[model samples]
Target: MSVESIDAHQHFWDPSRGDYGWLTPELGGLYREFGPDDLKPLREAENVSRTVVVQAAQTVDETRYLLDLARNDSSIAGVVGWVPLDAPNAADLIDELAREPKFKAVRPMLQDLPDDRWIENPALAPAIHALIKNNLAFDALIFPRHVASLKIFAKRFPDLRIVIDHGAKPQIKDGGAGWQIWADGMAELAALPQGLRCKLSGLATEAAPGWTTAILKPYVDHLLKQFGPDRLMWGSDWPVLNLNGDYAQWHDAARQLTSHLNAPQQQALFGDTAKTFYRL
Candidate 1:
């Protein structure tokens, strides 16, 4: 078999679906619908053989919508769906979602929730356990402030596979004041033996306008060192990524950022790590 490359964190969303409150008009370019067909040519151009479509809206109906898409698209290796983790019937919901084989993970929209302590809510415990029982990973959709809490959450369920989306979204447009906090939080999270992974996505959008590969290298370097190639995954973060850069630009930048690593390590960062962490 040929060695594979996976774009482990892209999203498909439709404004007509109306669940995504974040897709506002001011968001400019990303204010439209995007689907697998829209991304196929881009992924093909970058030689990405597969992709993981993640949840863009905090709705179970959206999850169902994505699962339906995955069922029809051979290129979608897995889905990270949304479920109300603190719901009274969260476990039942997880069981119901588990019926779909393509459901590989759950991402509670922590970044959108007003309560930062929500992850620590005891009511979510059963749902977290259900994810473990069902063998579903937890995609942590969080910001830097949420990282310290995430470390504690990861410690609670030591075996639950966790991947921090967008490198916890460091503040790149501003100067690097947030770096220490984000870096410290990430180190604490990655230090957990529970197997934490980070995605090298969403960085370009965080940088100042007219950013380049050199501008992102430090952030990318920090992630590679903290998680290593074995625990780090490259994600297109697609359509949203178009806010700052195109797929080919991000792909080339990632390749250059990781050029120091040997062939095997590069492969691990590009595909193997995501394949194993998400069990894609």
Candidate 2:
């Protein structure tokens, strides 16, 4: 088989279906609908063979919408979606969704929740256990503030596979005052014996206006140094990417940033790590 290139993080959404609380008219170009057709050419242009469509909204109905999309779209090899993880029936719901072949993981939208320690709540235990029992990974949709809790969460269930989305979204644009905390958090997670990984996505948007590869290199380098290629995955975080830059620009910038790695290491970042982490 030919070696694969996967865009491990990406999404397809339509505002009409309506669970996207964050997708308001204020987001400008992103306020409209976006789907596989919109991303097909972009992925093809970068030689990406497949993508993992992640949840942009927090609802079972939205998960169903994505699962239905994945069923028809061969290029969507896996899906990381949402569920009410703290609900009493969360386990049963996870079991049902786990039955879908394309359903690979669950992301709780933890960053938006009021409680930074929400992932550690005893109430979410049932959902967390069910994910383990059903063989689903957890995509930590978190920010830097949640990193400490994430490390605790990872330890509580060491068997559950966890991938940190967007390198815990370091405070890049605001200057690197928080760099040490983000770096320390990554090191703690990476130091865990197993079942932890990180994604090199969403950094461009984190930097917001006037971001370049140079501005992002330190954060990227820290992730690489901490997680290493085996535990780090590359992703587009696209459409949201439109706010700061375009698809090709981000792809090219990532290429330039990681150019120093050898062939195998490069392959791991671009594709292999995501494939193994998501079991895709």
Candidate 3:
């Protein structure tokens, strides 16, 4: 069988541009320039037919940058760009980006912020609705604490398609102290309309450095149980995975996790779900 795969999450950044201020040298491995060329070898090695590039910085310019890249590169099947959801012309931004067919969705990096910032901010709600109005998905880059607010947002806007990134970012490295909070929140979010799904990437990074699938199994199993295989998708989170492991290592772990599932279910996790949800 051909090893066709679709990477649903990965990022690109240019250090000369000074865009990713958060990427410090102390973080070690992933603090260098990462672009399409850096990803090509790994994609070919793993047989990834296409990839969905998610935004790393919070700038509209980054959105346009990815759109331009997608226009030139067929390997980049879609892009999850960022826009100022609470800015004055948020609706206009969404509408404008929707004109680009490769602009599959928008993501605000809410997970890295303080717990209470824009979880349910009134101003951002309308902007989120504008995403739905324009037929775009919203990637929820949220932590466990933000899940409750995410539940509220999902219920309030039943029509919007939202993909939960990083398996709701469970606290694997923290001895799973925050697992219950994340699991409960995921249950609530999963109960929302069929639009809700989660990405099975970044789990190894979430664990302590040099962590293994045994360390990540609980969190992965929990998401599969809560969202089911059809509502789940796989993402390599490459280059970023260099912070903890390599692309092959991460991909193998994901394959091991779902090795028991039948062929169709495995296909959804590998590619079809993302293609269907993101309209790639």
TM-score of every model versus the real structure:
0.97, 0.97, 0.95
lDDT of 1 by residue, 144-209 (tens): 899778877888899899999999999988968688988888888778887698998999988888
Q: Tell me the whole-model lDDT of each prediction, alpha carbons only.
A: 0.91, 0.91, 0.86
Residue pairs with clashing backbones, model 3:
none
Model 1 misplaced regions, further than 4 Å:
none
Extract clashing residue pairs from model 1: none
lDDT of 2 at 9: 94
Q: How close is candidate 2 to the true structure, as a TM-score?
A: 0.97
Clashes of 3: 0
Residue-level lDDT of model 3, residues 74-137, one tens digit each, is 9999999999888989989898889998999999898776654475787887688889888899
lDDT of 3 at 152: 79
**179-242 per-residue lDDT for model 2 (tens digits):** 8888888888889987489999999988959898999999999988988889999999988989
* lDDT value for model 1: 0.91
